[model samples]
Target: MSEVLTTDMDRDALNNDGFRLSVISSTAVLLEQFSAVYDNYPSYLEIFSPIKCQCGKLPVNNYPESLQKQIQRLVNNITEGMETQRKPLVMQKKKPPPLKMFEPKIEEVFDDRKKRKGGSKEINEKQKLVHKYKKEMKGAIREIRKDSYMIAQVQFQEQQEKYASFFLLTLTVLLLLSMGYKIKWL
Candidate 1:
């Protein structure tokens, strides 16, 4: 007979169980603390309870029966453990110091105002310079556009003149060739 070896899947299951146990312990500790606090103020439990469930049943009822039983058992164990491990709670005598809020000094406010005024003046001067440069650039662009239009017009006129001259020269040569052929000048 051969013995079966445990695989990584088994290790994973063990790891998960360990993780679940840690989570349960931590949760139980928190619940234990909350229970103590709630005992001091019974109204807290009333406020913490769910108001209504959409399913018309308690939220816990939504869980499977076995899981619910397991949860109840876990809670019971936690309560027992807490009863054994927890120490008696003590009331505090001295309260923590109240927080101090920041208030700006008069001189600091005045200094900030002075700085803002100087900064605004510089900003205004830079804006005016920018506006001036923008106007100059726009004017330059307009002049360049006009010059380009004028150059294009001149080139078009030159092209038209060349075409017209070529047409007139061809007409004259054809007329001369016809006259020579009629006079028998081959």
Candidate 2:
């Protein structure tokens, strides 16, 4: 879905200061042609520029003495400017608060196992009592649910019988009215 823009087609579409960009297949040919036309074109393009090393220093030995100094100065200026632009890491030391210590007043009174041995019997009895109550409550709940279901069924049957009786009475009345004076009923 990308739109292709050609210099010929977009010549009048763009403003006067617009740049017409085209892909050059032969960069060496293009450079050579430009060099022949303009003698200082390579200086402006910096074709023989020195590459910066991993340590931020440029390889200036291949360049001339004047260019080596210029490159060194440029690298220094760049590093200085970067350092000035960056915020320095200010490390502040923090001291932790001291721990608190205290001494206990009371000493060992009696062995806890003896007390627990007597209390365990009472706890078992309480647990049995709670279990017995829970079983009885579950039985009572089941009985109550059964009784409620039976009551609901009885009420439903009574409603059905009432509806059937009302329907029969209405049918008999309608039949008698439709018969006019042709029927003889007591």
Candidate 3:
């Protein structure tokens, strides 16, 4: 959500020391508009500006050159000012990022189907890539469903652990009380 910011863009940049630009839409038009007119790349135009909220899309690979420079400068200044933040930010925890856990790599999926001895015609390069990725995911999902025994085993083990913990707690309390009563000759 971009503010009108005085309905004046270039003028504001030239006149005022600080100017704000908010993305009105997350379309390429807004990106292109800024790219064509402003001296920045299409990517950083919105980010470099004082963005209040997401006007449309989240991020882009291409941004205005000036905007990119501004962002770089801002990041450099911040990093220089606060050297401590880099350690945790750059050298993250030992665990891999959360996203890595969910999906199997597309390459791994395709490698499993290497023995296609039957006739297989070549597909359009773009479509082949897309098809390969889709088939990989589709097959992985089907394979997961086929492993019902492993799934049931996991479920049974989870339930057993829950009951075992509950039983252990109850037995401990009983043992403590019985010992105390026996010590008093009850």
Quick one: ranking by lDDT, best first? Answer: 1, 2, 3
**lDDT (Cα, tens digit) per residue for candidate 3, span 19-77:** 22223123333444443344333334344343313322434235555555544444443
Model 2 clash number: 0
State the TM-score for model 1.
0.32
TM-score per model over all chains: 0.32, 0.33, 0.21
Identify the runs in model 3 with alpha carbons over 4 angstroms from their true place: 1-145, 181-186
Better of 1 and 3 by TM-score: 1
User: Across residues 107-161, which tens digit of lDDT does each residue of candidate 2 receive?
Assistant: 8888885444355778978877887999999999999999999999999999999
Q: Which stretches of candidate 1 lie over 4 Å from their true place?
A: 1-119, 181-186
Candidates' C-alpha lDDT:
0.60, 0.55, 0.52
Please state the error at residue 42 of candidate 2 in Å. Answer: 99
Best model per lDDT: 1
Ranking according to TM-score, highest score first: 2, 1, 3
